[model samples]
Target: MREWMFKSRQKLLTAALLLVSAAFAAAQDGAAGIEEANTKVRSYFEPGTNLMYAIGAVLGLVGAVKVFQKWNGGDSDTGKVAAAWFGSCIFLVVVATVLQSFFGV
Candidate 1:
C-alpha cells in the first residue's frame, strides 16, 4: 500500500511538470503572435498616416464650404466658425505629421 501511494505521487508530479512545460510552450507561441501583430501595425503606419491626411483634407473642404455659406448668408459668427473649423483641420494635420515623424515611419 505504501509503495502504491509513492507511485501515485510520482505520477502526479510528472503530470504537473508536463503541464508546466506545455504552458511555457504556449507562452512562447503567444510572444511570437504578439511580435507578428506589432510588425503588421508598423507596416500599416504609412498608409494609415496618408489616410489621416486624406480625411483631414476632406474635412477641410467641407468646413470651408460651410464657412463660405455662412459668410454669404451674412452670419455674425462666421469668423468664429471659420476659426474653429480651421483649428480642427490644423490639429488633424499636425497630429498626423507628428506621428509620422515621431515613429520615423
Candidate 2:
C-alpha cells in the first residue's frame, strides 16, 4: 500500500532525472551538429545561387525568342506571353537574391 506507492514514486523520479540528463547531453551534441550543418548549407548555397542565375538567363533567352516569334506571327497573345515570361524571370531573380541574403550565404 503505502510502501508500494513510495517505491513507485521513487522510480518515477529517478526515470525523470535520467531523461532530463539525456536531453541535456543531446542538446549539447545538437549545437555542434547545427554549426556543421550550417557550413554544409553555405557550401551548397553558392553553387545553387549560380545555378539559379544561369537558369534564369536561359529562360530569358527562350522567352525572348518565343515573344519575337509571336510578334512576327501577329498573335494577339504576344503581350500576355511576354509579360508572363518577364514576370517569371523577375520572380526567379528576386527569390534567389532574397534567399541568399536571408541565409547570409
Candidate 3:
C-alpha cells in the first residue's frame, strides 16, 4: 500500500512537471510571436495612418466611458454630452470597421 501511494505521487509529480514545462514553452512561443508581429507592424511603417487609427480608438474608448458614467450618475447635462460622445464613438467604430473590412487591415 505504501509503495502504491509513492508511485501515485510520483506520477502526479511527473504530470505536474510536464504541464509546467508545456506552459513555459507555450509562453515563450507566444512571446516570440508577439515580437514577430511587432517587427512586422514596425516594418509596415505607416506612421500617419497608425496614429490616426490609434487616436480614433482612444477617442472611442473615452467617449464610451463618459457615456456610461453619465448614464449611471443621472446627470442631465452630462447625459447629453454622454449621448453625443457615445454616438461619435459608435460612428467612429463603424467607420473603422468598414475601413478594416475594405482595406483588409
Who wins the lDDT comparison? 1
- Candidate 3 error regions (>4 Å): 44-105
lDDT sort, best first: 1, 2, 3
Across residues 1-105, which tens digit of lDDT does each residue of candidate 3 receive?
Answer: 999999999999999999999999999999999999988875564554455577777887888787788778887788679668667766765676676566554
* Model 1 bad stretches (over 4 Å): none
- State every prediction's TM-score relative to the real structure: 0.88, 0.80, 0.42
lDDT of each: 0.95, 0.94, 0.77
Two-way lDDT contest, 2 vs 3, winner: 2
**How many residue pairs clash per model?**
0, 0, 0
Give the C-alpha miss distance for residue 37 in model 1, angstroms: 0.7
Choose 1 or 2, whichever is better by TM-score: 1
Q: Global lDDT for candidate 1?
A: 0.95
RMSD of each: 1.5, 2.0, 12.7
TM-score result, candidate 3: 0.42
In Å, residue 91's CA in model 2 sits off its true spot by: 1.8
Model 1, 1-105: lDDT tens digits are 999999999999999999999999999999999999989999999999899899989999999999999999999999999999999989989999999999887
Segments of candidate 2 deviating more than 4 angstroms = 1-4
